[model samples]
Target: MSSAFEVRGGNRLKGEIIPQGAKNEALQIISAVMLTSEKVTIHNIPDIVDVNLLIELLGDAGVKVNRISRDKCEFQADDIDLAYLQGADFKKKSGRLRGSVMIAGPLLARFGKALIPKPGGDKIGRRRLDTHIIGFEKLGARFNYESDDNYFRLEAPGGLKGTYMLLDEPSVTGTANIVMAAVLAQGTTTIYNAACEPYLQQLCKMLNSMGARISGVGSNLLTIEGVTSLGGCQHTMLPDMIEIGSFIGLAAMTQSELTIKNAGVESLGIIPEKFRSLGIQLEIKGNDIYIPSQETYEIQTFLDGSILTIADHPWPGFTPDLLSIVLVVATQAKGSVMIHQKMFESRLFFVDKLIDMGAQIVLCDPHRAVVIGLGRQHPLRGITMSSPDIRAGVSLLIAALSAEGKSTIQNIDQIDRGYQYIDERLRNLGADIKRV
Candidate 1:
């Protein structure tokens, strides 16, 4: 995929969108199934490039990857041909996806120890893995970091033993690591202040299906009783809430009515409330969400009926990943709203693209931005734009497509990393998007 492009905006989207499975959750869940040498069958795995790439990487090192159905997969790591994970491309690709860190725990559990190269994903800011390291260390894993060598090696020479550990932050990846490692440990392991996001919860459920003992399904605390081995289990992936949120923003911005079937309403907990603040209506009927075409959604007023603020926090709070979509939607909203991206400092940098398209916004700092919506006041003329990160880039593409003309967004590779066949998927619902 080329890294650049031009966009002619101004198109209203109209259609029905069935959300895909969550990529983040699928990645971690697949890795977690490696606890035992047994066969694991998974369903609803998105047929995207990254998933294929991960499968290829695993296959080369000798893990059986098979297709049982369109969205189903059967995998077994009984024959791990390569004991040492040494390859530039593998390391680089592993670093690309958010779930790459998850394989660390599974690898250790299978091989007793493993070498991890520095991970790569969104360059929002310094995404720390200290919590993951500390949690593993508490389970009797020792680490050796080699800066010049670009290798981070760790080992559980005496095997991992269950221990109580607290996460410094509600990191999804860190929590996943601990969960994976503890499943095969010697005793009971407790994780406090852990990330209980839908993805994390999905991982736990998948692990349990594979015979791992876990308590506290959807809370900040987790209890895992180590098991000697695990066997294959059939599991389905959850709907992508982030993608659903993106579609809601797209529908609102383009005045396009859309039906998101089986939207995983249960996982959308406080997300709807956050989007509602921007006047985006997500009407639920059974498992579907109805986002009607509206010229401009109204932003909520404050307690004094002035103005309300929309900010991102940890899980159970508004997801920082969806804030980019919110910003794009706010441009067409009736009133002004503040967007606080407290998690990553560089996340707000992409606002410059929206600003260039004539959206009124002020970048307060690295982590804050105040958007004064145009309220259908001025039509946004499409212009050339490039995607910076996965979420922001796709949000920009949505904005560009929802604007006034034919828009071509570049750096689509980043967008493809998360959204599977986004152009085709959106086009099925009447969105005019094509990759050049």
Candidate 2:
């Protein structure tokens, strides 16, 4: 049987934990390693299943992968086996991860041909690839989809040329793909309404270090001047903002005085403010967030005295990934809040598990839920439940830690894909949780 977390609830956790490296950022950076043939030493990589799987995929494609430490790895893509990318085994491996779609851009830019199987990931909603495909096509690439095989073939035989494109949405992965491809195209490429998240900025900076011309970073508009080739450069990942937010929610829900160290506060756009609206008080000291034990937190209403509505948006807004944590924290606040998960339809479905655990929540629809805080007036009863996805898994873990009696969380692999040694970390903070 797969591993499960056996959690004994009602413990006030203390001590400090550092946020791990960004999982989403690591995926993009690792894929960009294929853009250069030189040795790329990346530091602060997260130790997680999803990232480890991507490293394995790269090795299968003949990229030299060396693990120097638990959090550092070097990759050299000098001898990429293009034949392996079209094989059945490669298709099977790539299909298991959504991040695999990103490989198409680097491969196409370097070799002018790339194949991708239908990618798989968290079934949050309809995560379309049209943005990535459209961006590639705008750069003068011809794309063909083999419906029967459920795979994609992208080619730029004459070589890609830079052009202008305004993405329909600011998709993070889409932006990374187009940027990587544009870095080697024949001319200057302009991208409007681009994703300017810190991750994208870091990736852009890293590429520029390897001789790519990119301007207007940290904004919606980006300009990339193509280079004939790219060289290897060392890159470090930022702290995972989603993980920091999750820890904040966990500390508040369990009434624990916990401190999260090296949280990279500057990159955390609007996340702390969003948590503050939920009545969760966090003291930011330098790069650390301190959450003191509180008897109760009262949710704040809008300036118009209307009920607070916490929703997700693109970067510079509350991230959809952390909405699950927001909703879980609202269940213990002194007032009610409506959580509107704008990006993913099925993400709010995890409220059912919290509702079963004595949380007063009304699932208005697939994307919205109203949580009425019980204010620690009532203790939640523990129950066995399976994890649904990465974010929801951590949210459920937080709920379990605050509930009464013992709780068992199965399918912990879902959590393992995003969080690194979460059970052991929680245990370090005085949580009565054990991996069974």
Candidate 3:
């Protein structure tokens, strides 16, 4: 059986907490290591289950992996065997996480062919692979999806030649994959409507350090002049912004004066501002976020004095990944807010669990939830619940920390995939939480 968290609520947590390395960036950067055979040294990597699984998958493909430290590692892809990639065992390993789909770009760029099984991850909504597959096809690669076995095959026998293409949406992983592939193509490639998240910028900068000619570092339009090969380079990942956001919400809901150190405030786009809209007071002391304890916070209204709605969009907008935490935070605020999860259809369904914990939440639809804050007037009663996904699992954990009694949360494997030693970290903050 999977481990669960037994949380004793109503604890006032204090002290500083450090956010881990970005899980999303680690996946993309580690896959890019296969683009070169040189020793690629990476620092500040999150020691999370997902990242470890990706590393094991790379090892299965015959890449030389060395764990230099807990937060540091090196990769050498000199002996990458194509036969291992085509085997059933490799497919099973790749299917364990969604990041496996990213291997297709580097594999195809270097070997002219790639194969992948159906990617597995949180079933929040219809996350279509069309963006990735179609983008690869637009760049002169032939892609075939074997529906019988749910596998994908991509090939470019004549070698990829860079071309200009416009993406339907700014998909983060899609842009990373295409950019990685285009860097090794024969000619220049211009990608419009590309994702420009800080993680992508970091990836592009790291690629440039590896001798890949990529321009437009922080914009929707990217230009890449194909290079012959990529050399190894050193990379340091930014702190996980989602984890920082979670910590901020945790401090607010539990009414604790907590500080998040080295939060990479510059890279956190619109996240601090989004939480501030919920009337959560924040002090930015250099790179640290200090949330002071408060009895209650009032949700802000629109300039027209209407109810404020929080929704997700592309980068520079509030991320859909944090909407569940935002919903839980609203439960204790002084007013109401409508959380519209525009990207994922099933994410808001987790609100039913919150409602059972004494939160006044209305599940308007699978995509929307209206939360009316109880203003700390009535404390939430702890209850046993099962975590559905990563973000929702953490949100429910936060709720349990501020509830009236002890609560049990199951399916903690979902939580471990993204967070590194979360229970231990919370314990250091004076929270009575344990992994059972």
Tens-digit lDDT track of model 3 for 1-436: 9999999999999999999999999999999998998999999999999899999999989999999998999999999989989888887778878999888999989999999678698867777787788888877899888887789989999899999999998999999999989999999999999999988999999999999999998999999999999999999999999999999999999999999999999999999999999999999999999999987899999999999899998887788889999999999999999999998899987787888899999898898889999999998999999989899999999999999999999999999999999999999999999999
lDDT of 2 by residue, 272-307 (tens): 998888888899999999999888889999999999
RMSD (Å) of each candidate, 1 decimal: 1.7, 0.9, 0.8
Candidate 2 segments whose C-alpha is farther than 4 A from its true place: none
Candidate-wise lDDT, in order: 0.82, 0.93, 0.92
Give candidate 1 misplaced runs (Cα > 4 Å): 1-8, 82-93, 96-98
Q: Candidate 1, TM-score vs. the true structure? A: 0.96
Rank by TM-score (best first): 3, 2, 1
Write down the TM-score of every candidate: 0.96, 0.99, 0.99
Residue 95: error of model 2 in Å? 0.6
Deviation from native of the Cα of residue 318 in model 1, angstroms: 1.0
